[model samples]
Target: MAGSAQPSRAQLGSDQSASFRPYVAADQSPAEFTAKAVVIGALFGLLFGASTVYLGLRAGLTVSASIPIAVLAISVLKRLGGSTILENNIVQTIGSAGESVAGGVVFTVPALIFLTPYGPEYFRYFQILMLAAAGGLLGVLMMVPLRRALIVKEHGVLPYPEGAACADVLIAGERGGGLAATVFRGLAVGALWKSLSWILQLFRTAVGYSMARTSFFPNATVDLDISPEYMGVGYVIGPRIAGVMVAGGVLSWMVFLPLLTILGSHMSDPLPPVPASGLRIDQMSAQQIWSAYIRYIGAGAVLAAGIITLVRTLPTI
Candidate 1:
């Protein structure tokens, strides 16, 4: 039994050593690395940044689908015989910038318009851009300390599904596969859809509807239909998470909205009007309270989920 355990331990050690082997290692001067970084960064930055803007405009949803796209881009590049570590890292960093910015801008910058002297309508020009760039810098800084904890030490523990996908794309690129074309096609379709939607006013940002003001074409609501942005989201999220998102949407739209309207109608006599839009607790209802305050329960659940993941990964680190 002792002899058998020795072989098992030795095999485990060998497997880890093999897994740690670097693929597409680049031995180069600092200057060369810098140059490569700049070139790769610029390329991926444009690729992902453009993608973010397009998706944002199309769906009015700030999506982080760029991570997978970056990975796919790197994979295609690798398959084309240029699978370099420096290049791929540069791509990851650059591509990640757009997502980082989009996340921050979507969450924070919109609040600025409302909080500032001008309402969100005033930020139609460059608020999003400014916030996005600033968010990019913040993301870079935030992820720096995480490098050791996430990339180097954790290894396979955290999954880093995005990173792994990018690595695979890079590898595939080295082999001259069709991923490059597929990615480019996705980008083109996404961009065209966004541009056309904006021009055609497919959705309206009017005060009453919360941005889903498209005409009910052929007896169907536009929001319920899949668009380029939704397709991109589905691609990056895969099937399970996509299902979760769709479920959430259905719950919010079909269940919550209906329930709120019914409750509001029934309680209309007792309480004052809910008002067009203001932060008055007196005019709100149990449903409104649940939607506004109790929704934090869901936020806490999400936060707890993230914390639990981090905690589980701590042992691996």
Candidate 2:
């Protein structure tokens, strides 16, 4: 193994660094963090933030706004007399920050509003604003330490697909190639598809079919949302994570729901904490059963998973 011609540490590092080059060199300083960039980014942030909140409230999930923001920023800045790659990146970062904050607030704050004895009225605008600000500050503070390690040093070692995609968009815009045109075409197609479903009402946005009740299986159902957004997300996350998500859905719908239905159907009275409606489990639909019981189980499972993950990562932290 001695005469195999292994590269020295310095040579290896140089090779690795040379493999990936930034659109703008490190030594170059550009018109980044400019007043126009900040203003444009803030405007986009507010726009996406509002939309994210609405989407989260409706669907309990939010789409990543980074790519769209980057695309828009590039187009806008080009029309406004051109901008640097770093300026566009700064715009994207600031705009996506709003979506991130909105996502976090919508997911957790609603639960607090519902669960607290003081009720939704207790959470005023100022209180919610403060909560969001604190969460965003904490997140930024935590990432400050890890940014160099995970984002900079690791680089290709960690498959940060979203970040990579965003960077590609910025670079493509800067280079003025077919890649940027393709992105705009995709945007147009997505917009048309959404309009067809939402505005024209040509078809259902979601569809579902409930399986017939049998001796073995009961209250089983399958549902799918026909949305470009979800498809894009699944593609971005890749098949393995998507498969795991599908498996969880199957466990909830096919396994747990049927078992619960079979066991509870024989009972004459309504379940506890559900009020005395005199409706037995057998009378309830799959959706009703899920709302009444299975959601709590799912929530518990998520809590357990989070705790386990935190415990595993605590040493590293």
Best by lDDT: 2
Model 1 local distance difference test score: 0.56
Q: Which candidate is the best by TM-score?
A: 2
Q: Give the TM-score of candidate 1.
A: 0.61
Candidate 1 per-residue lDDT over residues 89-135, each given as its tens digit: 56666666655565555544544543455666667657666756676
By summed lDDT, the worst window of 10 consecutive residues in model 2 runs over 9-18
Q: Which runs in model 1 stand beyond 4 Å of their true positions?
A: 1-19, 25-40, 53-85, 111-139, 188-223, 268-317
- Candidates' TM-scores? 0.61, 0.77
Candidate 1, position 227, lDDT: 63
Q: Rate the local accuracy (lDDT) of all candidates.
A: 0.56, 0.81
